[model samples]
Target: MINKIVQNMAEAMAGVKDGMTVLLGGFGLVGQPNNLVDALIETGVKDLTVVANNAGGGTTGLTALMEHGRVRKLVCSFPRSNNTIFEELYRAGKIELEIVPQGTMAERIRAAGAGVGAFFTPTGVGTKMAEGKEVREFNGRKMVMEYALPGDIALVEAWEADRWGNLTFKLSGRNFNPVMATAAKTTIVQTQHIVELGALDPQHIMCPGLYVDRVIHIPYGDPPF
Candidate 1:
């Protein structure tokens, strides 16, 4: 029997190591795997390069990770929030930042999962984001080439999961979880509910079991950091 469920947070995060590029799923705080993020912080791994939609806010999840100085760089669309963790680290020269356009960032992650070598888009054409990148013309419009974004590990949160690792998200929580699941070497999920193998409805499963490597049940509520 193939079971992807793990009994504890440590087992779920066993493969994470220092200096790895980690993809974090969430739009702000909605879809983040707070449990896994907290575990990663506890592991004390350093020099991580994180890819996410926005730099985290408040003193939990991604923001807490940044505050601990575990991350070396961040590849994200937006870095500013009500919290000053990212800004403090950035101004103090403790971290590196790569600003990618929101649409391009999503496409890059999707491209990695689809096995695409590269893609061209007009989102950042003629801007500093396009600097040093190969540009081509299609129908007289300039497009900048962006490569796929892959991660060593991806931490995601799902509303529900089964023993097989199939996942379902609630409303806006589905944001980047599905794509991040596919674009990482090891995708570890923190699900609120872990059901029996056949419990998940096939039509509603957003992320298939094939893409998930580990799942740990975390239930509902904010996990301590």
Candidate 2:
């Protein structure tokens, strides 16, 4: 009876603390764990460093955390979205922002999960993004060194999950969830459907149970935005 299922968001977020780096799985608004995000905000944990694809849209989800001044820093590929919270905070010297190139950011998270020390890529060479970083020649092409990015906790959403924690995602919703799952110390899932132990097809499982620590069921619908 190795059930990873948790009763509610509070239990799933129990071990999270202040001043931690959290990985949020989503590409814009899709694939985000809205309930978990809301729970984290409710916990009132301040000084968090959140890593995500974008700031957020509107005044909910990740933006709610920013609006409350809970996030001290944001490490994301894009800060601009339908919402202007991130931009306002950055300009007012209220929040820190680190803009990683999209592909480079994904690879960095993957490298962390794969136990890689560091990697070199030509993604941001000869730009301000490459400043103060190691650069070397690989096949006469310059590559900038990027380090692995790991998180204290990761919150991801899934289309379906089982008691064993195997997860499947819908199309574009699968974007950063899988990689973020493996790169965090604790991976918590907010799933739309919870099935029996053997319900998930082996081939369809995008994120296996070993990488997941907790799963909470939050049915898919019009989530609070």
C-alpha root-mean-square deviation, each candidate: 1.9, 1.4
The lDDT values for all models are 0.91, 0.92
127-208 per-residue lDDT for model 2 (tens digits): 9999999999999999999999999999999999998899999888899999999999999999999999898889889999
Poorly placed runs, candidate 1 (over 4 Å): 222-225
TM-score for each predicted model, relative to the true structure? 0.96, 0.97
lDDT for 123 (candidate 1): 88
Give lDDT: candidate 1, residue 87.
92
The residue pairs found clashing in candidate 2 are none
Task: State the weakest 10-residue window (summed lDDT) of model 2.
Answer: 216-225
Candidate 1 lDDT over residue span 1-225, tens digit each: 999999988898897899999999988668878779899999999999999988886678899999999999999999987788899899999999999998899889999989997999998898999999999999999999999999999999999999889999988889999999999999999999889988888988999999999999888764333
- lDDT for residue 158 in candidate 2, whole number 0-100: 92
